[model samples]
Target: MSFTIYLRCFNGIVLREALRFVHQKERFFSALVRPLVWLGIFAAGFRSVLGVSIIPPYETYIPYEVYIAPGLIAMIQLFNGMQSSLSMVYDREMGSMKTMLVSPIPRWFLLISKLLAGVFVSILQVYAFLVIASLWDIIPPISGYITILPALIISGLMLGSLGMFLSSAIKQLENFAGVMNFVIFPMFFASSALYPLWKIEETSEWLYYVCFYNPFTYAVESIRFSLYSQINIEYSIGIVIFTFIFLFLSILGYDPGRGNLQKKGGK
Candidate 1:
């Protein structure tokens, strides 16, 4: 494709998703509320449980809210990524996705543009959450905020691609919502989002291993390390590998004559 045409198509997809985001103000608030509830309520309960101890990402004793902040940020991206996929499924059902799919633009380019739009919105929501967290005096270093961007971008892409792969298999809106319960909650809970892996290990060895291996764990860990103005090379590498693999699977899942959505559309 010509450079101009590619840019045109990319911008169109991104602009549409941006407009959709703006129109749905509730999504922003909803994303904020879920994490804030955890920070305010769940963390309050856990605060006494963990009892002002040192954590890996913190040099000194920190509040539970501070400790869980990165996990909550990951939670925001997780939900937003699923929201993007839900929108994709809606678009497919409405025939708009099919229209885009049949366009002369490369499928990979279309998919990448769509995922970028989703990641863009996710990053915005996460930063907004950070601002709110700061208001509650759960502030990280100013530089940590800046340093966390790359982590957030990589994490968003990983989650968004997983969502896209999911949308491809979900033929209807009801089915998509139902299926997300199996994926999203398990991912958030089974990861370090709520509790440390060692904590889980103290309870169930298998569950600890599950959390250790979860891609979402690395997502949370990357953000956790970044929020401390450091980096987790293992988490960063895991996210890179997961993003590429999921992106490839999502592309295959969206293919005509072979994938689930196309098969349902054929029916």
Candidate 2:
């Protein structure tokens, strides 16, 4: 009976999330469009202007479009993860999150359920982008399709937890836009998403070190490795570490008594 109830709770959370998404179809469409613009318009325009150098994953010269796919994938997940966090903040302000917190289920379970729901939504958007990429002859290996799922889920969890952590820390929606600008763009550009660390190394060794240290860089590299059906041991380890650290911080942030969320300035 206990097991059955647990399953029911999980299913209930999943169902509620799916229904919420269905009701807000425009948001889904808008999320999908953002990445499409980056890939179809931005990448296309800049592919030629940006010259490529030998990078680890690439044995030969590859198109800039092909090179940036993994980064773009990471970008999509980053935006969605942050968006999920933003929605949580909105829900809290609207009182829905407060209701969720009062449920009988463990707080961790509630958090995981929300994380899983965000993962499901982000993965759907990713696959949609992949299908479109295929039409443009930008598909990765057929085997990559299988490996990509787990990588995507890991990246999703990391980003979603980041969202949760940030949501807990920031009191107002107005402040979030500032974070999006100051945090997200720098995180994306400074990583291997736009250029190889080695290339960045030639320009500035410190910037390369920064890229090496950025958790998002590992996530992008993990996605890139999976795209070729090749394993990157460092990326695999980095992602696991990154996910756990972010998750731990998120749990800490969500703790009602000790977390920043309950602070006067946050409200």
Candidate 3:
């Protein structure tokens, strides 16, 4: 297809996703609410109990709420990714996915376009959350507001790709809710989102390793650093690597000839 056609296709997908997001007020509200509850209530109650020492990107001891802010931001992207995946499953059931897949435009491009559309929605949700958090005096550096965009995009794509990958394996729309809970909770709780890896290490070495290797942990850390106008090269690189891995797998999963779709006789 011509480059103009590709551009038009991308714009169409993004516009449709944006309109869907605008109509789904509850989805946007809930995305903000989940993190806000953790920040306003959970963080306040645990502020005294949880102490964060100076770590990279953090020059001194910080409040629990401030520390978990990046994690919560990552959580937004994580949930958005899964929500996009759920939409893919729903589209498949309704025959829209098949229609789109059969289009002359490349399948991989279509999937990536859909993934970027979800990321676009997620970036908006995250910034809204940050604005609300700032009102509560949990602001990051002023420059961070601008600097964190790249990190947000990378993390969003990685998490969204994960959702796409998961969706390819899920056959039924109803089963996806269970699969999402199964994946989301463990990835969130087991990572450094809520606690420092060192603290987890002190409590349990194995759990610490899990946290160290978890891709979500890297996503959180990368955001944490970027929010401070700093960079964690290692974790940033990790996020990119994980993004490619998950995206490649997702493409394979959607392939009609050689992937999961073939096993199901081109579902």
- Candidate 2 is scored at a TM of 0.94
Positional deviation of residue 198's Cα in model 1 after best superposition, in angstroms: 1.2
Q: Model 2: which ten-residue window has the lowest total lDDT?
A: 258-267
Location of the lowest summed lDDT over 10 successive residues in candidate 1 = 258-267
Candidate 3 backbone overlaps, count: 0
**Per-model CA lDDT versus the true structure:** 0.88, 0.85, 0.93
Q: Estimate each model's TM-score.
A: 0.96, 0.94, 0.97
Taking the tens digit of each residue's C-alpha lDDT, what string does model 2 give over 1-267?
A: 387776788888878878887899997888778777877888889888888876766777888888888998888899888988898888888878888888888787888888888888889888988988876578787998988988999988888888888888887878889879977898899899987787888999888899999988988999998888888998888888888888888888888779876784444
Candidate 1 residues lying further than 4 Å off, grouped into runs, are: none
What lDDT score goes with residue 263 in model 1? 71
The candidate that wins on TM-score is: 3
In model 2, where do residues sit more than 4 Å from their true spots?
A: 265-267
By TM-score, is 1 or 2 better?
1
Clashing pairs in 1: none
lDDT of 1 by residue, 6-118 (tens): 99999999999899889999988998899999998999888887754566778997777887899999999989888899988888878788888989888989999999999
